[model samples]
Target chain A: MTALAIGIIIGCCALGAGIAMIAGIGPGIGEGYAVGKACEAIGRQPEAKGAVTSTMIMGCAIAETTGIYALVIAILLIFVAPGRFVDILTKAVRQIP
Target chain B: MQNSIQSRNPDRTTAKKPNKFVDFLLVLMMILPFAGCIALKVLFGNPGKGINVTGAQIYFTVKMPLQDMYITEGTAVSAAVVIALFALVLLLTRGLRRDPDTKRQLVAEFIVEKCDAFVEDNMGRGFLGFSPFVAAVMALSAFSSLSSLLGLYPPTSDISIVAGWAVVSFSLITFYKLRGGAWNYFRGFFEPIPLFAPMNVISELSTPVSMAFRHYGNVLSGYVVSTLVAAGLSSVSAALLRMLPGAIASFPLLRIGIPAVLSIYFDVFSGIMQAFIFAVLTILNVKNGFPEEEYERRMRKKQARRLEREGKKRPEREKNAA
Candidate 1:
């Protein structure tokens, strides 16, 4: 029964982690749009390429934080949070016997 | 050696062929780490049987009134390696001439010149003095992250290490903002409307938090993903190889060269890219903290008022000289 319980908990966590990764879509789109605009601007004024590239990189780095946040959440769900729940589940099962 | 700075790269023949010296150093670099690994294995028996996914291993703890500080393996080992590398680089570039005869001097000059120009172009001419601090931070971050390539836990993957640097950056931002004026610094919180002060304050605090988390998350996720992939590959290779004949079945050949390609992107590219981005963000944030032109104008106006008070008799520099 405990083995069955642990499997279900981990499966749920996998689902949550998958859902959390949807945050990547937002930043991926935003960054692509920003870069597209930056490319257009650079094309119009090639001399400003250095400034444009630097600014775009800085902006993208900031935008990337949200996607990174999602990744962190997913990592936590997969690696860290499951262990605690498993421990608790095991302890509860042992006490009931 | 006799050439002036104007005679740039003067007489390439002055560079004595350090071919043997380069070979010797390269050999030392390889052998030292390999020997250390052997010594570590002898001391600790074998490595843990399976993958261990945790932050830097806490070696010991120091108690304080407020909080206990735990010094981890990453802090001790990686820090020592970083300092040794810094010393080695410093020693190499020690006798560098202004005219740049040796390859060592050229490397040193190239780094300094690039950093100076990068800072100057990004943050304007007035912030040129900040190049050293920015470069140092970048070097520390890049090196710390790259330490993972040595099969050690990277310090950058730990939030505490990255947060410490982020806090320093935040403090520098605050210090620069105060340079404008105490009034302007305090007044900024109430910009647009006084009701927005709380939001501004929260945003101000979140800057460091966000920066710290961004770096920490990026490095940690990469490290974690790579660890998972390696462990997965070992098991899969074992399962696959089991069908083969006796001796060959035992070897996990798939684990050999495959991970190196993945590491090129995760360890090398991401490490350097994140360091560059962090340095750029730090510079830009600090530069934007104060109104540079307004501060200069205010200082000039104050100086003019002082001159008027002194009846313009002695002049500014003469009075200081006197």
Candidate 2:
């Protein structure tokens, strides 16, 4: 494989991981919105504090799953994908020769 | 008056200290996991010079027909420890009398009653029978996560452990829905219109996966952050202390005292909160799965049976029990 091809694969993997992490923005904003509403709810009915807090927590955790999924994908890109590209490219080169 | 009260209940005032041997055994149980971990680290572990943010360490692999089975260090050890802890609690609570003679019995009863009350409050009185199962899940999840504080590998840090529990809860949710009525349960997926069926199916399927990932991610992230912090601190300390004399320079001075503070949140707080969230989610999911009408019908039968026993106009509290 040419050096440029290897560099491009590595660069793309880096770019992909960085892009995948942008998925965190959605969860962050969503969770913040949920927490903001929950705060308003608890303020409106202080007696319902425990219920509101728990419900808010569950909602936030669910919201966080999207970011976690992104983290998993980014992890794969960094640790697994780059090596695969190189391995496949080298194998193809050997077969051609 | 306080003295009089104490005299009236001599057993409560003068309850014997737990047996010496039992106390020793309890301490031993707490210490054993940490000691075993340290010993293993000394003997067979190779934690290289970097932060270890990974899943359960594969302790061994067993041959299988189609594929090999990899056993992890975390799941096996934590499972044994948690089971043994449960057994020990059970053995201590054995042979209880009508009136509590020992504080141990009182404590055990307190736990059981509290578990029942939590279930009743959250999932309604119809779920009183589920209190034991709820308590078991809470205890298992909490213990597994808290084990990381002792330097033992946390079982819940591995996705498989949480995923297994999530799957169990998912099936229980399905079972409750089935009990409501098979036809209705299946047909409800098409609800309000047929075009929405695929969306409904996806939503239904997301429940378990979301639960598992939410929990596993939180706990694993906490573990990873704690590890990174410890490593970072060590490096920062080493850089600072390099100018010092030999032994002091080599030692990780910052690592000794700093990680414990972060650990309070990462290990203790996050562990407990995740366990609680998991339990609450399980209870809510199961409760919601059953049809509301079916629940009302079952509750009415229970109330009717209670009314027969009481032989009077049912009390206000009894009405709310529905």
Worst 10 residues of 1 chain B by lDDT: B1-10
Docking class of 1: medium
For model 2, the superposed segments whose C-alpha errors exceed 4 Å read A1-10, A38-51, A79-94, B1-38, B245-248, B292-322
Clashing pairs in 2: none
What fraction of the genuine interface contacts, i.e. the true contacts, does candidate 1 reproduce? 0.88
- Residue B195, candidate 1: alpha-carbon lDDT: 100
Point to the candidate with the largest DockQ: 1
Query: Against the true two-chain complex, what DockQ does each candidate achieve?
Result: 0.70, 0.44
**lDDT tens per residue, model 2, B19-131:** 66766676676567657765664565666545665566677799999999887767665665675566657555653544567677677778887888899889998888888
Question: How does model 1 score by TM-score?
Answer: 0.81
Question: What lDDT score goes with residue B189 in model 1?
Answer: 95
**lDDT string, candidate 1, B1-322, tens digits:** 2243435544453555446566567556634653454344345444656776766666678998999988776675456555645655654555444455567778777787899999998898889889989888888898878877877677888888889999999999999998888888899999999999999999999989888899989888889888888888988988999989987886778789888888998899888889998898899899888678668867876787787798875466745643
**Backbone steric clashes in candidate 1, count:** 0
